[model samples]
Target: MNNINSGWRSGILEKIQGRLMKVYLLARRFRKHIKDLKNIPRTPRCGLSKQETIINKH
Candidate 1:
């Protein structure tokens, strides 16, 4: 019984660890993407309407 319990617990722990790793990887990728976006230069729009430019800002 004890061996079965330990096995079950380990299985659950592995599943939790796998899920945490996936979340961590996704967060890292998202952060990198945000950093890349911030590094990009914003060019001035020549002919866009004020409302359009404002909308594009966000």
Candidate 2:
């Protein structure tokens, strides 16, 4: 009876550890996705960007 109880407890512990590992993996993947998204190229509109010249005449 004692051995059966111990086995059941160990199984529960293993399940908890597995769930924690999965959560960590998901967080890592989400972080990588955000970093990769930051590398994507963007299009400038209105014929201007921060590097372009702007001319104003009065």
Candidate 3:
């Protein structure tokens, strides 16, 4: 009976560990993606000027 209990506990523990690892990897990937976005340069707001011109013409 004790052996069966231990086996069941180990199985649950392994499942928990696997889920934790997946979450950790996903978080790491998200952080890297955010870092890459930050490294990109900002562009001027030309779209706003175009919109203003169109509004003025109407």
Candidate 4:
């Protein structure tokens, strides 16, 4: 009877650990995605080099 109880407890613990690992992985991916989004606006827009040259001539 004791062995059965111990086995059941270990099974539950394993399930909990698996769930935590999944959440941690998801959080890491989310952080990277957020970082990429933050960089998008800081990047210079495309096709503006011609305007920049005209302005620089002044």
Which candidate has the top score in TM-score? 4
lDDT of each residue in 1-58, candidate 4, tens digit only: 9999999999999999999999999899777756755665656765355444544573
- Across 1-58, the per-residue lDDT of candidate 1 in tens digits comes to 9999999999999999999999999899777756655544463444235534544564
lDDT of 2 by residue, 17-57 (tens): 99999999988976775564454345345333322332222
Task: Give, for candidate 3, the lowest lDDT window spanning 10 residues.
Answer: 36-45
In model 1, which residue pairs have backbone atoms overlapping below 3 Å?
A: none
lDDT of each: 0.71, 0.65, 0.73, 0.74
> Model 4, residue 13: displacement in angstroms?
0.3
Pairs with steric clashes in candidate 3 = none
TM-score per candidate, chains pooled: 0.66, 0.58, 0.66, 0.69
Error of 1 at 55 (Å): 17
lDDT of 3: 0.73
On residues 1-58, what C-alpha lDDT tens digit does candidate 3 reach at each position? 9999999999999999999999999899777755645544463467555544654573
Cα RMSD to native, each candidate? 6.2, 12.8, 11.0, 12.7
**lDDT minimum window of 10 residues, candidate 2:** 49-58
**Backbone collision count in every prediction?**
0, 0, 0, 0
Model 3 lDDT at residue 43: 32
Alpha-carbon lDDT of model 1: 0.71
Between which residue pairs do clashes occur in model 2? none
